[model samples]
Target: MVFIRATQSSSDIACIAVAPLSIQPFGVEPTDFDAFWTQQKQTLAQIPINPRLTLLNTLPSGAKVFLLELDNIDNRKVYAYLSVPAGTGPFPAVISLPAFGDAPVQPEPLIMTDFAERCNSINLYISAHNAPPNLPDPNAYKPDDLSKKDGFYARTMIMAGIRAIDYLSTRPDFNGSLGVSGMSQGGGWTIQLAGLDKRISAAMPINPAFCEQDGWRFERASGFPNYVLVGRNLNVDSNKTLTNMRYYDAVHFMKRYRGALMFQVGYEDDVTPAATQLAAYNKYRGNSTLLTMRERGHTYPFDEYFLGRYAFFEQHLIGFKNPFNFKAKFLADAGNDRTVKDTAVLEPQFLVNNEKNKVSNIQWAKIEGTGNVGFQTENGKTVARFSQKGKYLLRVSADFDYKLADPSVASYYTLTDFVTLDVGESSNIDVCDSDKEAPNFSNCPQNIALTTMGTSALANWTPPTVADNCGTPSVSSNFLPSQSFPIGATKVIYRATDSKQNTAECSFSVIVTKGDSSTPPSKNDLAISLTSVVTTPRPHSFTTFKVKINNKSARTFTDIKIQIPFPSGIVTGGAATSTLGEWKEWCSNNDQCFTWLIPQLLKNDEAIL
Candidate 1:
């Protein structure tokens, strides 16, 4: 539903339209990175406690699943199913854990299989040993199995995953990058192992269960069952347990750990809750990405979502490129122009250049309205995640209606500005208004005037100190070498607003050039490489060998001229050269063959003879 809020008096009326979620969506623009992150932290402060869950799963390749048992450092045997892939060499591996269930019923064998195929890594599953293990000590698997204080399950299992990596290192085929993943309770442990174990290069935890647990009373029957079981065994107070669990919580642990992580969440899910998942996410300051489902439940869009997750781990963790790294394009709403609403979509390429020395992630926010908003991959197809509040287009489209009613009648309201994701500090852009018309500057002055006064290679320039009615004016420059100006983009785009609130833009380029009169070469370690070629008759007059000097005083420089001094016959002149390009000179050789003439030079000017 959309409405327009208008201020009207007899002769004139102004309208600002209100649109539903379908036409306008809310999100932080890239300029809001700091604010958004700050908000996330503030939210975390409100909910201080964390939750818990226990998970178990099968690791496999049907060829032959074996009950492989291993002992931890404490010598307690831990049971696991090891599934070796069909490859010849040592394969990369991932230890899989399933969401909490009392029994290892329908073990998520398929996901483990996918792990092998997708990641080309070995899969090891540590089953949730619900029943008591046949042990010498009755306390091992009892109702209050506090065998080793806070129990050995956490440390032992994490070590088991590390051991798998060690075992992988033994095989000649292993590449040595370990990735860990799990969902629900599994997600919690995956986080734990990833943080505590330095071996894990990548980790993905989906719909995790260990964050902000003040509300989820899992001690009750219908609550998250895995939390209940863990609470019962560990004698933990589920409500106040999170504060003590901080040492064990993956979220807190990540602060001390650094590496790659991928988090997934369901916006509509109350189970692990998107906000709580984000709480864990916000705690992580390392390299990571989040994939969230807006209208989905706790049961994620596993096939497509997990497939993407595996692909991400394979590329970043395993250093593998996708076979279908193709290009596709789509259009999105930039708002309306004429009868057609202006739109913008990602350029039709699935991949952009991987930024040098920077971490980047691509995300699409849902936009509501008649025209649809979503991300458009390089492939021409559109993926729409259903929404009850409004319609969404994964990317901008061409078929959107251009005709808008009255002075302003928008179908949706934009809550947050679109983030401009770019490299470095240049990622900030302006908040655009849909109803406003673009400034008309097709006939403005095209000439650009730029000048520099310092010895520094015109590194960069701040926009001209200028302002307009809107307050201060701002602009950006695209710098290039002098030779590349204009064509190479030595231009600046200036944006200004008038007293009447009218905006105008102008562009100009500087005609840059190299400085005149090259600075002479210096005489550093300038020993005679070879002797002089003096024509007989005009014997090079060995006159006053005073060091020729210049007036360029920028920085102090030492110059030495080692000359093959000649007294009489075969006259020769010593030339000056420099390893550090600076001012220098050539003078007559004096007395001895090794008589060295050296002089210190300053910046900008040079010496000669």
Candidate 2:
């Protein structure tokens, strides 16, 4: 549940009730799921696996890097960068998938080098869709008619992964063990590929997308490719869309996957909600582990998360002991099952129980709100008091003294708690107008006093200043003072602003009557004239024009607006360059016009445009 309240100050305050993770099945395996995939693999097999390899400059003197391509189900081609160790009869392999969107999937020479020399494994980083391996082109591939089962891009992309595995099998240095890993859309593909292929030995999917298709129906976050279920992308045939999507849903795929699975989830991820990820994870009937990052939204800390993956794969693929075993606990007075008042005192604590590692450092952060509460460790207890009202995520991160076996051994753990603080009614403000009188052509009241109630309320005017036939007038303060006005009436508005940026306003009109000979004129006494510089002006041809404006009034004027219209078919070139004013172009009804705002024009003053 979420509640939003509009205040008299800044933006509305929001409080969200974090939902508990539970498996609510919304996907049903298609009746022809196995049959469809069986036919897909057969179709891919018929197309000769015309594998093409282009060797690039080898790095580190111990590995060879090559660009690999293979034909998939469609006429499209799949590309990847394959790095193989120097001396190897048959080496273990891992297939890295690309993320969603138009991000380039270039070969990472450093990453491939580490995988080949350090891990003693062949690494193949594959690109999804018909995307080129070296550069990203947003218009490379457009999804087909999603209403039909065979028209979707997921079908072809999934086939590409299957065909990649087939190409890896043909490698002279390929070992029997295989693994898949990716994040977001790539994560979804990893799980789907593992489920479809029984040869997969291990899988790690980080914040995977394209799961729980029906999540939007319950107001929960849906994965990428969720567009097919709502808005303009929604299929005309809802029933067929639902059935076809289930065939590609990750939850259905996880149910059949038997490989060792490790999943990473971010609790604050609106892209693929933790609930949806949990739904898929709970459905898996295999050996699996989940790493939850409480405050992360749509992404994970790459260094720590990848270290854990390296340890997992090292143990399973290389037959290593995986010595990295770090554990941490973060606790707060505000538990998951309860909500405290806005002014409640929060007591946070961090504990680490690792005999092999010592706690090196600790840090805390308030993810939301305008409170001045700062974390402090007093007597071995981490505590802070929150005084503001809003939603906040309190996070505590701890680093261990011991490092992992990978490039960086310093292992870290982070924990977070969601909190909401509700305060009383917001600050408010009120404003009133001041009455005044002034002789024609003479200055009126310059300032007015305002009556306001609330915290940090300020007075101001909407227009700030006004102009009439008599002269331009402005207020000195929040209260409107007597100012020069024309014979007619002029409206003056006064406003009040509160600390929270809330505003209230009131307006009054000033009327000026005819006066003696000493009184000023009631209208702006100015003359403007325009002339074409060219003697013969032709249609659709460019021509220069000269404009002159002069002020003949007794009083000075500022911020004067001058407008000039041009005939159609005569486009403007270059700039109208003004001698003493700012020029701006205006258009209406196929006609072009130019306006100049003269900053100041004293009596008998002239400006050229």
Candidate 3:
């Protein structure tokens, strides 16, 4: 198909004006994110380009709202409009990337209002030139050569985002501290800029797409025309291109991005597969967090209401208290099959009390008007009371927060630092509020017991029963009394207990031999084994000696202990070896089998005589 172009020429460039807003600093400093970006080098530029400036609207508060356009100066000029709080000697700056769809898009007036009035932060809506006079018809932009590498329109739009950052930095009143964020395509671009750009201190990407390509959709999902166009444009060399593109891929780049990030995804999403998103999430090796929506999908408010998604940006971008910071993730319920349940145990050290920085305490505690909830104690220990069960969100407040011991800290932010726990089958949830100053574990009660083994008829010892809040308890095992016996065995009994204090004892009997049964392998038949008898007495001059053995069905030979009586004491010798195949040698002077070989003989499939 031959492509047609329409051009609109006017010497005038539409400008976005900055709102006179108060910029608040999050008080956080920039972090080093070298290894993170190293993995995403192929898909990203070492330095971002494209800068433009324009005026938008005038606020009723007598503040001028301006837009700064960052063009992807390499080829296509992607534009991002930045709105700053006018008049100042450098105020904190916030750069916003637009959501997926068209470019040069403006946000809801309320969002702009929040950025200007409430957040006192600069705002930007960097969009692709997909609209009117400046852009080709959306339908005209097809996946072809020119549009792939040199003209992937969305990539150019992202270039505009970079330029917005440059433009914001040049402002006399713009502080170096910066924040970048967006949803969907904007989210993808935000993550890229946060990882590739050194100037941003924090980033928030909500309901991000393009996390995993091959992971789920195999290629691209239906209707999404952006990335396919990019791949085609880059003329991605079949073999080497994918290898190289892996570096530019968002999932790959996430590994190197150092800016603190708050990523949100939905579990029931049909659009972006959870597995693919999780693959990208796993690559983010920074001061970051992951929030999951159980019954949500790819929608607007749903993405916004996704737990910590908005709060992450509120704290990182606009400098506000994070509503989701409770410390210690006690309840991780991915209602559908998509839940991540790898929660480990929460350590006790996080319960300490500090009285200094209320900020640190807030980091540890959940302030509920009157008081806080957690293990709060001035001494060394903290004990909180739990009245009911269910999923409980715990928050800990501490005065002081301590730095990690060393670089060995794989996760700087502990799951235990903010937690959610499910209590009671009907009431089993008991959440704990912890602090970053202590040890943290995400999900506790991680079932690590061996569930299955190869042996079909093997005896599975019952898992030791566990009870809580009963102090340190002990466990002991007991075997049933046995007497001298013959073949025809019935049962063998064993018991386990934790003694008197709320002790639970379990007694079970295993049958060694079964003549015939319709049930085949019953519980008793499974735990024990009985094989044909082999009589190999210690060597004697005559070879065989008669020993009286009683066979009583009522007496039950299962627990019967037979004494190997020696008529002339035991003497290690010959013929006995021939009678016994691999059977172990008997003890000299004592007509008894070798104690060490009991395990071996028990497993040999031969019956003990």
Candidate 4:
């Protein structure tokens, strides 16, 4: 298996440049490449997008972040971190994709940033796979059919990105100024999406992948997924790979991309070869800027490129304001996943990233782990102790403080990441202990009815009673008493998180319906809103749904009943737990439905079913 290798220097690579060409692909594009993608787009248009959004957290800059799920190809769904900026109106948007693994591997790129608030844009962050956010995923990066071009994962991945753009364009809050960005595989997608969708006004791809995929044919190192030699069988002869890898290569898609593009090239990048990235850059015939960072490698472009990824859109007049006045860098290290012996005491060393100069605080959170586990600081070093033997995922996050370029914008931002480890057997010392319970809001507020003649009304309600097992849990709400609620139904979500990062949430709605102040309302004036429900998407999986009922009148009602008919072909499952009423399941001539009956509906009070 060993053979003599011929060493080549930078000059050797420089001399092997291809013939003079612009808007050229790494290899010949399939004759039906354009037609095939057009047909895919047509198919995507027919599928309905069932969107479900659940509020996760809120940034100090008044941005509401949520986990958004949308149905995609083959009954699959795409999950993303959706950030809605403060103060409503149409706003420009940016969709940031991910590289290699399902989610962001490192702490910095694990979640999202404050670009939505600082730049006043709607931001959507997606992983390489359609997995949930903030959790360790082992099912990611599964094998795909590489024998055929159309059967490859690249087709669906690119189409999913296009569908993301389609979702943004249809949003009433989107101002139509759209941009796509990513590093590595995500970078490759950034270019491909821009090429496929005309809605993309700009793109920022950092050390992009899938570039010059056929460079191996010329005895050169290609980008990621480089199929140079199949294992040890060097004698196996094969020159064709599903249309010469033309249909799925980003270099081929570059010829069709005509937009404002600013891509970065890291001279030290080995994952995605620098030569292939340069070759793709040369082939793009449209307006593009290549920012070379000699010190960086395969990483997020925010640090390596000029200013940051968001700054490029601002510089190019893409409708976003630059929020950078100085450079803010954080290098979080949770160490790598490694197997530990019997004791399982000397866990992965979690180091603070750039703490001396810019960081204001350092924190650790346990994302997920089996058995019992806790993290403690020993001799100024972060360590984890497990009570049982198993593999676990951990995270170390640092608060980086920096001055924003815009004085009016937020002064700082936040980003998170992860680390993993495997333990043989625990020593059973069990020194470090953490609170495992979340604060409860047993007396959660009831939905209220507010009558307003104007566009908005000052709605008032009592704060929910919170009880915590471990000290006092920090509680926050998206809506406060006497806060202005727009004319319509609005959900008031309150969250309580403990010191151990355990959290609980309870939400109710405020229904504001316009009515004549002089006229008395009718017998029934109610507004009902349903909270988002998340399911496994697997067939026959158990699911749960929460529905809130608000009485939008001053008059009390008695003997009220609500009926919900189940969709056709959905086999009924036992479900019923009422907070203020009784639920009855009845079938009328083969059709199934649920009926809830309330003896008394109090004025301005809400019922849950």
For residue 539, what is the lDDT in candidate 3? 44
TM-score of each: 0.40, 0.52, 0.44, 0.48
Candidate order, lDDT descending: 4, 2, 1, 3
- 10, model 4: CA deviation in Å? 17
RMSD of 4: 25.0
Q: Lowest-lDDT window of 10 residues in candidate 3?
A: 17-26
Candidate ranking under TM-score, highest first, comes to 2, 4, 3, 1
Residue-wise C-alpha lDDT for candidate 3, range 418-521, written one tens digit per residue: 24554333222332322212222212222111111111122323333433232234545543222222223323322222223344444444333432323232
lDDT of 4 by residue, 515-558 (tens): 56565445467877665355444686655666778887785444
| Better-scoring candidate (TM-score), 1 or 3 | 3
Clashes, model 1: 38
lDDT of 2 at 382: 51
Alpha-carbon shift of residue 567 in model 4 (angstroms): 90
**lDDT, candidate 2, 1-40, per-residue tens:** 2334443222443334342223455666788989988898
- Which sections of candidate 1 miss by over 4 Å? 1-64, 73-75, 105-111, 114-119, 130-149, 152-156, 213-243, 319-609
Give, for candidate 1, the lowest lDDT window spanning 10 residues. 410-419
Measured with C-alpha atoms, the lDDT of residue 368 in candidate 4 is 60
Superposed by TM-score, candidate 3 places the C-alpha of residue 412 at a distance from the truth, in angstroms, of: 19
Query: What would the per-residue lDDT of candidate 1 be over residues 352-455, giving only the tens digit for each residue?
Result: 12322111222344322432232323123333222122223232212111111222322111111122221112112222212143333443345443222222
